[model samples]
Target chain A: MAARKPIIGVMGPGRTEVHTEPVDKHVELALELGKQIAAHGWLLLTGGRNIGVMDAACRGAKSAGGTTIGILPGPDAMDISDAVDIPILTGLGSARDNINALSASVLVAVGMGPGTAAEVALALKARKPVVLLATNPEAEKFFSGLAPGLLHVAGDVEGAVTHVKGLLAAQQGGAAGGAEQQQQ
Target chain B: MAARKPIIGVMGPGRTEVHTEPVDKHVELALELGKQIAAHGWLLLTGGRNIGVMDAACRGAKSAGGTTIGILPGPDAMDISDAVDIPILTGLGSARDNINALSASVLVAVGMGPGTAAEVALALKARKPVVLLATNPEAEKFFSGLAPGLLHVAGDVEGAVTHVKGLLAAQQGGAAGGAEQQQQ
Candidate 1:
């Protein structure tokens, strides 16, 4: 049952609003991903705040009556967004590290900066499937040359979300196939 | 010249979506505030990202052709949304201190959680005008006991924006009056 609902962790800043571009597109894509995840009965984990893409994704999940989890750092000094259904305040030493380690079964990093790079590296070390959306080209150029296929790049939000969904489905199917063979 | 267009620091979380009790009310308020701020020719500073109220506010500011500044953290994260014209990455340091100690005319906090609380305290400590929207009950209780006119509370977005505009006007008038008295 737990395997059925794969957790999808989204990595980004928790308490800052960074809008270097039009946010509506990202907001739309995030909500769409949330809807798709809910439709597929998957869990959505994020840095929870009622602002930015985190809130947009949660709105999408809740609109579809899906369960969303927010890993918060503190209650008084820090917090998740208003859209979070479950707020887990872990007071972890490394804010991004804890969130990265707990985002989901497969991690998706969108619009990352310095803080999330270590999380991305951690995901790579863990051998977890990672999808990068609008990530730093320099970082990609550097990391891709270092280790090919460690990061999956997408052209846009649609491309990124679709690619991740496909990866998730394949993993689920492969796991089910193994279970069936064991039963036989 | 810098003082003429006083910087207004807007703080909130990134990547989270909002769903107010009545639905869309908070968003409407956030957008209205952005529009009002732009109309007043005030600079809008925020965490640049495409999500939640941040995006909405950016949209409003850009539509009005107002200058928007994104105070980003980290060296490689692309958290800036599309509407941002100027992007400043402040490395990995906590921006709370910088934002609170900002040379801004006023500080407006939208619907946010604990992260918003930290900024609110920072603004208060800096003796800046802080207007809080969608604040928690405990915060309201705390503010009520602070002083007679330290904080101004608004029920909705229009009220909040109007209240801030009024504050800005009064601040300008007081400064001008003081300048005249000094000359005499």
Candidate 2:
């Protein structure tokens, strides 16, 4: 079988949250994380808007010469960030968050807002590995009671990238086991 | 120009909410609303899942000999209701909710769960007219502060349909003005 390229989905605040100094810091964190993911030869997926953490991550991935896919909320390509290598216009609006969650083999949440929180919930529901980088109190509170193995809180880009790699390894291991079982 | 057929998006709870007596009432309401929408020559759109209010609405529309569209969350057609004439497999997951909201010229919200509430918010954000039938306190509270002209609270299927027709007329009037301006 051909080696599958991992797709990591990054979810965070959009332009509605405004670009304050604190918000800009979160965007920077997302950029570093995007760069690390691309360096590992993984594709990055985001909300595909030209604002907030999504744009930052897409820019970082592009700078690292990595392919990035933006799953857009509307059919119009105008809302897509220039850094995105591919734009998937779903026209699904906020519900598109589920696409962001399910499309990724693993998800990284940079900051929490209503939209981001919804994506995190969907990712958790799907039992996908979620790495949180500089999450807000609401996100911390939402995942507080969940089982620890599925959720990881990373304080830095390196830690987030490491967690993502470990999760990817575990996912590949499980897939291999399933394939073997089917063959048997 | 050909007269456009209005598409009405219906938002409600999913199967996870269970089909109990109370829940069934909501489904019945959705069914009646769907029938009324179809009878008015308008198309009905729902989440496309077979288990909850989505199924009921689709069934009602089909029974009324109306065309129905299901904006599915997942890529597979298996989850789509049999009564749906058209199944749009977005593979976008919950993000398909935005498609539902955006595709419809008007929206009918039967019950509000997190998913349904998100759709309502999206519809409102897009400036689409939304009709609430038997809305919960949360939904009622959410719309309480919005401009009265854009939101309608209907008690029955007839009332909902009436509100939809009125809104559609208002929309057409606005569109006609734009068309006239373009011609000039």
Candidate 3:
């Protein structure tokens, strides 16, 4: 289950067409984000596709020999990224976005699109912290307003990772405090 | 695995406090909606809690002698509704809402809240038709805008069931057309 280390969900937009694949700044950021997540000994969870941010992040994690879990939308490995170490075929379509949101202790979104936006919303609805990396200003503002302090806008990949760390630490601290209060 | 009949997810707000349980008009609508879904031989699914719309709908389904699946947030049956024939303990907290959204062939939300809003959003994002019985106007507008044709507003429980039937028929027709085109 790879529950040993904390899991960080890196969700973003994915393109199906090879020609439309924008290997731009966002893709670069996603790749670096995966490396940083792996370097910190955290598991990387993604949408598990062969193109766009999902593929780039998974490949980056694999390049560093880090574990990756890709929750695919379909119930097969037809479009799974080779870099994904564990591919879960849900057959639930985009609804699996909930699993991606809940499975991670903290979510780090590299870019914004309908898919990533849904994941971000689901994460926030579940009361999980989300670090948005270079997403558009509109999406940034919209999602941030949804859950207040649950949203963190990071300037870059490292900043996103840092936000992830801070958020996870805060959550753990809150959980511990709650446990203590319960005992009292 | 009750796949013989399509499953309809009935989601709405739930409260932990027994005294705060709102057995109001929305609860009545949800119960009637569940009965309508069962009368059509469709399976019903919910959050599987002891309070709120989830409990009311499941109880309604059981009164009609219909099978109900409850995807509980916790990993145990500590607060599961006795009316749920099958309980899926995900322990994913509110994240299980995604499964509720994905598992159902169609989603019928009788009221609106943060939890139900998330389910409605996820269902729309997945391109599934959702029938809103008596949700708020703001939620109705926001979710309807998210997916142009997927959001169906119904005035009452019977109207909601009618919308569900119409949407499912349209979906099947579209699928059939797509399959015919593929064959051609």
Number of the predicted model whose TM-score against the real structure is largest: 3
Q: Where is model 2 more than 4 Å wrong at Cα?
A: A1-5, A13-26, A35-43, A47-50, A61-100, A109-173, A176-184, B1-5, B13-25, B35-41, B47-50, B61-99, B109-170, B176-184
Tens-digit lDDT track of model 2 for A1-184: 9897999999887863325656577788888877887899999999999898898898889889899999998989888888898999987667678788888999998976556756765677666788888985444543543435678888889998889999999888888777765465
The 10-residue segment of model 2 chain B with minimum total lDDT is B138-147
Q: 1 or 2, which is superior by TM-score?
A: 2
Query: Order the candidates by lDDT, highest first — what do you get?
Result: 3, 2, 1
Cα displacement (Å) at residue A109, model 3: 2.5
Docking class of 3: incorrect
Of candidates 3 and 2, the better by lDDT: 3
User: Considering every candidate listed, which one attains the maximal lDDT?
Assistant: 3
Best by DockQ: 3
CAPRI grade, predicted model 1: incorrect
Alpha-carbon deviation at B122 in model 1, angstroms: 0.2
Shift of residue A9 alpha carbon in model 2, Å? 1.1
lDDT scores for all predictions?
A: 0.63, 0.79, 0.81
- Give per-residue CA lDDT, model 1, range A95-151, as digits (tens): 334354435777776655333444555455445677776665654553354235656
DockQ of 1: 0.01
Instruction: Order the numbered candidates by DockQ, best leading.
Output: 3, 2, 1
Candidates' chain B TM-scores in the order shown: 0.80, 0.90, 0.90
